[model samples]
Target chain A: MMTLDQDSIHKHSFNITNLEEIPGKKIKHHYGLVSGSVVRSRNIFADWAAGFKSIIGGELPMYTRLLNTTRNEAIQRMIAQAEFMGANAVTNIRFSTSDVAQGAAEIYVYGTAVFVE
Target chain B: MNGLVTAYLQNHELVVGSALLIVGYIVGTLFQRNHLRSIQEREAFFFKLPAVTMKLKSFVPESHWDQIESARMVVGSVVITPDYFRYFLSGIFDVLGGKVKSYESIVDRARREAILRMKESAPMADIIVNTRLQLDTMQPSIPNMPIRPLAVYAYGTAIRLKKSSFPQSSEEAIRFPDQDIIL
Candidate 1:
């Protein structure tokens, strides 16, 4: 029968001796991973709707653009964190949302970190 | 005098009635055009799904995250291109003319965002098993138009396994050539 260990990556180890010295070795590697999320206040997103109603009229285009930009920024931040850890890969990635207030929304990013070797 | 007065009044009424009718027609046509435009835009936005999916996948691992063994749930989201709003309006025009095909940029943006988020949350694990894709629309408030954002997430139970239980092909293990002792 298949055991839990059979399904785990822990069972494997990579040999990095042949490869050039990676920068991460000098710095203390974080035992766990890091993550980033971009969140917006509901009121903030609502401004787009109000803007559409009064100015452009029908379908707020500005807000969509804003959110897109924010999300990208958040993602970039997360990647930077992983790179700093000297990790080539990450696992168990997940996202979550929370209502910060009546007019606010929060986006959350979470993941796991591992050392390849 | 009575007959002449009646005729004058009839003529005035006819002119006013005709004018109102013409105005009504113009207003009706304008409203119809606006409605049509909105519908076209909606269609364009929805049609962009495939490209968005493809673009988002590029940033995320095409295969499952290999580090996790089991998972209960997974969820993620990414904002489309910054110009996603422009496209929403342009898509409306495109739907009518059949010319709305620039979804690659948006898709790429989404993929990158999702992967970045994934990286942030799950940096140390070797693999993230059993990933799923989720799409959503973000509208901050009733006053704001909803922006379509997509996310790719891979979730599984994170575990530590000894070298014997893991798969270590030369190609996959080459990244860590220094840790040859365990092998």
Candidate 2:
């Protein structure tokens, strides 16, 4: 049991899956809910540019790029935390975003960690 | 029409408001129309890309397939904001408390565009599973500021099934992706 516990803590490549099951793999264990979250804010320069963009606007690509990177970071962190528990894959993954402050926002990624064979 | 224009022009403040309204309406409507047209074109072009629900789970069950093959996550992102014209329309609409058509369509177009782009990333996948759309509303720090941009992101895991018995389609379906390039 000691050796098995240490082995589980060592880690493996983390996979993010939305489906409950990996197509052809057998699930060895279910590790319950795992999540990662991050809060981000833009600098003054970008905010100034975004302010100008709001006029005569169609798409604000800067904010899009910013939030995209933020969300990706959150997902990566979630997978990393799950992997420390010996989870090979995260299933039924979902994302949520909320206001942290005036300009700052937080993105949360959550899923069930499971060891799949 | 000419007399009404002259009447509005006679009042200095009214003339400025009228001019702004006229410019906003023309430019705003033009942008909205063009965007909708492009969205419609792409929707039809990517019609062959199959998108399913989380309820479907994986395309192939474990008993049906020997190997999992490839399962990759795909994303489609769109950031859309209201034009100056929509801002003007919204200001008036808010006081009257009616639906703001401009914003409604802007969000609609963004959502549809995001989904289509995600589907594009894995065109050959057997099925798109557990598709999730994340919409983030962005605003400037100042209170009651006009700038509000909505970021719509659609994502899903595209799984490739190795089954050889899947039916074949016409050559047209094969060639559609070439013409449907989002860039």
Candidate 3:
């Protein structure tokens, strides 16, 4: 399950903050914005079922699971990006979504990478 | 015999299509109502959680606020494809050039549910700061498909807050039906 060095980077070292600073850490190096993103769509069967469900109008659990998985995937890739950059923390983390095509969308995550002591 | 056969074929197609339309409408309505009810019940619990956004400059420091967090990012996202009835209604709205109100509530529910899930995943989060939501309305896979799914993502810095020294005593220790509401 763990992917070697990436696990170490993910476990405790990589702190995330939206504000300029964390509580009690001194930031050393600012490596600019690093990001991870992915685009995905449901399969033909799921789409067909979703279409049927749309008529009556309720929550599409299948689509919910799909989105949950895709968002996690994108965030993991973002963390991996920060790890590759030799950074210990990320601040000003942001998430954004946009349509790439019909039935397919992309989730993009970005944050400022920094080294902290 | 040929004319009879042709008439039968046309009739059969119409019967099947109409049956599906009616079925989709009836079932979709029930599902939508149940989903809304579920959201209302969940919201009564989730709203009590001390979740806020860092969008403005009014930044609440986790430590100063007595939050004891390990500095991690918590994320929650949801995708909702409209029911066939709403999809058809939206198509009509598109032609009429009006606001697609039918589709709005689903997105709102998805956004709230995503934040709820994020909070659930990170139970120790004092308050989810820098909270943001993204909505992506997918286009149809085919020229006129009924499956235009919209994905909503919610993410934030889920920091642990020292709950022992916070205000808002009225909103304390409200338990969720599914999970314990531990802030």
The estimated TM-scores of all candidates read: 0.33, 0.77, 0.75
- Go through the candidates in order and give each one's DockQ: 0.07, 0.24, 0.40
Better candidate number, 2 or 3, judged by lDDT: 2
Model 3 misplacement above 4 A: A1-10, A101-104, B1-17, B55-68, B95-100, B140-143, B163-183
lDDT of 1 by residue, B98-165 (tens): 54443443344444444333322332333333344454444345534343333333223222223223
Best by TM-score: 2
Best by lDDT: 2
Error of 1 at A83 (Å): 2.5
Top-scoring candidate (DockQ)? 3
- Residue A71 in model 1: lDDT: 45
Off by over 4 Å in 1: A1-31, A42-59, A115-117, B1-183
lDDT tens digits by residue: candidate 2, A19-103: 7766667889999999999999876666677665555556666776777677777877888888799888988888788878887
The C-alpha lDDT values of all candidates are 0.39, 0.70, 0.65
State the lDDT of candidate 2 residue by residue for B83-134, as single tens digits: 6677877888989998998778878988997887677655556677778887
